[model samples]
Target: MNFKYVSYLWDEAKAKSLGNNQVDLLIYRSNLLGADLRLTNYGGGNTSCKTTEKHPLTNEPTEVMWVKGSGGDLGTLKKSGLAALYMDRLLDLKKIYRGLQYEDEMVELFNHCIYDLNSKAPSIDTPLHAFLPFKHIDHLHPDAVIAIAASKDGKAINQELFEGKLGWVDWQRPGFDLGLKLADCLAQNPDIKGIILGQHGLFTWGDEAYSSYLNTLEVIEKASEYLASNEGKRRPVFGGVKIQALEKEQRLTQASKLAPILRGLCSSYQQMVGHFTDDERVLQFVNSNDLDKLAPLGTSCPDHFLRTKIRPLVLELAPDEDITDYKKIKEKLIPAFEEYRKGYTAYYEQCKHPNSPKIRDTNPVVILWKGVGMFTFAKDKQTARVASEFYINAINVMRGAEAISEYISLALQEAFNIEYWLLEEAKLQRMPKEKPLSRKVALITGSAGGIGKAIAKKFVQEGACVVLCDNDADRLKGAEEEFEKTYGKDSFSSNVVDVTDNQSIAKLYQTACLAFGGVDIIVNSAGISISRTIEETKESEWDLMYDILVKGQFLISQQGVEILRKQGLGGDIVNIVSKNALVSGPNNAGYGSAKAAQLHLSRLLAAELGKDKIRVNSVNPDAVIADSKIWAGAWAEGRAKAYGVTVEELPKFYASRTLLNEIILPEDIANGVFACVGGLLNKSTGNVINVDGGLAAAFVR
Candidate 1:
């Protein structure tokens, strides 16, 4: 239980050698203890350290809390590789937890802590660091300890193993309260070597990094040994079948494809590691006539719905036996997946509150065929390793535990409570909602205007592979040049589209969806306006305007919603309506009426799609400075001449009408569109935001 065992980790951190990223420390340590902690089958645990820096001249220091951004493992932590945050801001958030219940507080506080802040919110254990007095912290739910925790009398077993040695806390949610509980317990037990969270995981720390780490392992080993000696010997359940070797290359290929989706399902998979083995237990289990019955027991834990879902994939081919090649394997597997998903959805619908975020996917992470050993998926090799280690250890432990007593999982509703519990969902939302528009190919009809180009640029900035469309080829080419110059080459495409034509809109949406996996977001910022008072307006003029403005908007929103709702993302549709819709400015009947109609359309869609979490928002600008072809052509110069002002003055003329007295740029409107994604407005639907630099006309109820 001394620091001697992990001094190397301390040395690495001291020398600034772990990595330039925050997770470097955790990743490094996880790797070091992989075999012992099984924290990572290959490399799983992730760690981060936070520090603040001051601006030299202002002397008004900006506090930055750097965290591992996206990648790395806890076994290692370093500098230069973390996302930066304002420390004071995070510290202030600790106040929100004061009187709120743990469950309620977790969601609000977690969202606030990570909300659009510089870094990903610290791990679920971040509140622990905030609560602890130590400068270094380590969190690992190692397989060895989980082996003990998952047992029938886990709490009793832990009490016996660490009597008067380690601090203990009943499992609470993992963030701040968990931290608070551990901190309080540790305070009472000053001489405690470490702490073990009941039924969840382990925590260890010391004044020095190495000492804290080794203490974690020493305790786990103690638990492992205690369990081994106390449990009576039992017959091998795995003795039923003969063992055979599994093929490495073939399994690896299959594992690779499943790993990404699996890893996305569970944070545990980040430390994935692989070993080709034909252990008798695994072989016997796979070859058993009742293999299907045993399949569900192999998941790392019952709570892995976030990553591995609830079901397990069955592989019939043994590792050593020759495999049958068939594309229909996936085809056949799809139905089973559908069945699993239906069960999950029904379970959630039965138990969840009206507003709970719906279950999005029910895909399994591990494939255990009758013959093939098992395949685990993860975000990286380290994640895969972690999932494998946890699952493998659990399977072994559960088998033994079943001999002692029956094993039952928490109810599906209970699992759902834990899964969609606000705190966890807050974390999911706090991380930049996956760039909605990024991966989806999009078709922007009016590509040559300020709003259209702004939305297009927004998608491109988020890494979406884009397809740009406009009626004029030359103007499309010009918009493409500006877009590429701004976003980098090949990120956008030019397509000639007559958006009023239904055939064209359908083709464009299909093209974009197929090209980019699936269309996630669509911005219908294309429209036309002819200013005429009621007396001056004509039937033909109104028809043409409706064909593009009202009709085009209707077509795009309808098509976009259909694709999005079907995909289960409930995708986003951003309409560029005029501020005149809110406060009509003595405009022509066609423009004003069409804009008003579109506003109601957006509102109706919002109400209908709320169930799907498909968000619909409108960005209504007072008057934008156009960079699109609409402005570059005859319209801009004509408007300028009519106003007796130069084209440059047109922007300022619009700027003066706003209360803010600030000029609105394309980027300003761009910000409005960007804010519509995942953050700032998870609950916002069918809302219109004014990007008018303080214009009162765009204000809406």
Candidate 2:
């Protein structure tokens, strides 16, 4: 509504493109609209432009409609993302179409009408945009407009609010039929500036791109102002006893325990990854007394049904229930998810048509658990985040609508039609193959920095949801933010955990379960080395060594196996041992002995857990100097002095000592870890992989 369109940005977009100027303009406008979350969130809205260009083969002028393509977010849309359709060819199909019973035929017609054979698939709403008369059209589900449109008296309120400026179309499932209805509505009201699809969204168009964009903003701003004036003073209050507010750490601790249980309950044929949020706004709704009554009303808009389904599954915890009690939490979670599944099946059966696509998995995308918090689940992290964002926005809009009047969403049949629409089904089918670790979760200790961080990055890149654990709270926070920015907020989470403590190690497993359901891969990379002779070493120093190097591995791995066994899914554990474990040096008695014991522990666990298909392996690296916290400052200076060189030359000296004469990096060690945990060495467990640029002494027979 603020209309922050800067002229220079538009100029820059135009200046870069010589051909396909229309697409360039469309991308520019789409980005502007998408930049404002109020206008659209994630992949919710679409834009299109009409243009005439010469066909590449025929050299004849052809009318083309370039519309936003599927799977591409408008905020980062590129010219290639716009599907170019031959307008004359598409409009001609309306004449030849015998009454089509199934929507699949209509989708086929649209696909055949594409002017560029290689263009990305057009959006499902392409028919609606094509049927409209204007040269440019913009459609968005703005929260403000939805607040007005979803009100109990939505149609009447829209009519009153816009006066005669906008036309109204009753809720129709988005397909050819709805597209035809939209065209009919516009034809009936020739002078209207826009069309408001009841409980759906807003559509505006003009001869120029800017006009359509501006009209959308103006209409949304007006609706926002109208709502503010009428209902701004009221605050929604639920009748529940406000539980004593817990501190942030306590809330997170509770969430960690509750998350895994709910995650396990939600898992189906395909694993479901969970992402939790105690976000202030989300908490306000989940904690509200009216949650059971209000949360079931349904999605704010129709397109949302594609991702979030009709409504969230609300799990009501007992007022006095202790969330930290894992056993009690499990008792509550199982029944709640099962009940939700049954209700979903009933809903699907009631509304499904004979030709409707197969029912989507019954697992709910959004879950509102009492006392704990809200969670969103998906096949991968990015999608989970998107679903979460939409639901949060829906909560705000529904709250606004309720303040004005009882909020109402579309009928179940309408939502079902959109959810099972063949176009969306086809879009899902057309998605590229998933990465190797697509739905798997990996937990890496010492991930706040060093080799652990590198392993975490690699796992995330390969499409695994990563849970990063480290003892350094400050570094953990920084790592969490960095990974979230690069891989998306849902892909990675960081927890401050001291591996030497059993409780802390248990918390790490809980965090992984809560953050990503349960773990399939565990990497024990947290370690320390003490440079002391056997005669000089204190008893405390030896205790510290064994606690971190031996006992820590046992505790974390033990907890990880428990969660993995619950999941009944095979898992991998990669321990970061050292070359010293295989070949000891003077003054390395404590560190070397501890690491050797850890190596044997890995072998024993592999032998014990092989029946469960849990693989345990170790990677022994000699002197990885770069990006290693263990080798920083005094340690590096001391090693350099021992090698008769400065710190800069120490790396070269160590590399020369190796058979391969190559300096080993953290990434090199991570690659070895990856081989063990990434199923590359699935059949070769209880083995030591030397990642020391081939140190002869450390070679395993």
Give the best candidate by lDDT. 2
Error of 2 at 360 (Å): 3.7
Model 2 C-alpha lDDT per residue in residues 1-701, reported as the tens digit of each score: 24332111244445356354666677778887888777778887889999998987899999999998877788888888889999998788788666546654777778888987778887668888999978889988888788877888887888888887898888766667777888999899999998888787889898877677677778888887777677635554433435443556766766665665666667765777777777776776777666777788788587576778889988766424576456666765778778888888998899998878887789899987665567888898678777888887787677668767778877888788778766667777878988877888998998888889998999988889898988889888989889878987778867889887888877777677666767888899998777766787889989998998898899899888877766556788889999989886767788899999999999999999999888989999888877777788566765665456888888888988888899899898988887777656778878888999887778788
Residue-level lDDT of model 1, residues 1-701, one tens digit each, is 24322222335545277454434554454446544434533223444445435644576756444444333444443443344445565667656666435535553454454422445434555566656565456666565565555555666656676886777776555556666788798889888776766545577765444555666667766665554554444444533455444465454443333322222222221222222223455556666543555555433343343444445566444343321222333344456556655665686788898768766544445556555455554322233334544556555544534433333333456566667876567666755644544334455667665667777777677656566877767877888788768875546646677778877776666444322323556677777767655776778988988888878888877766655543444457777787867775653567778889888888887888888788888888766765654456544565566457788787887778789888777778777877886356877888888888776656785
Worst 10 residues of 2 by lDDT: 1-10
TM per prediction: 0.48, 0.86
lDDT of each: 0.57, 0.79
Q: What's model 2's TM-score? A: 0.86
Q: For this target, which candidate reaches the highest TM-score against the unseen true structure? A: 2
Give the local distance difference test score of model 1: 0.57
Residue 424, candidate 2: C-alpha displacement in angstroms: 2.3
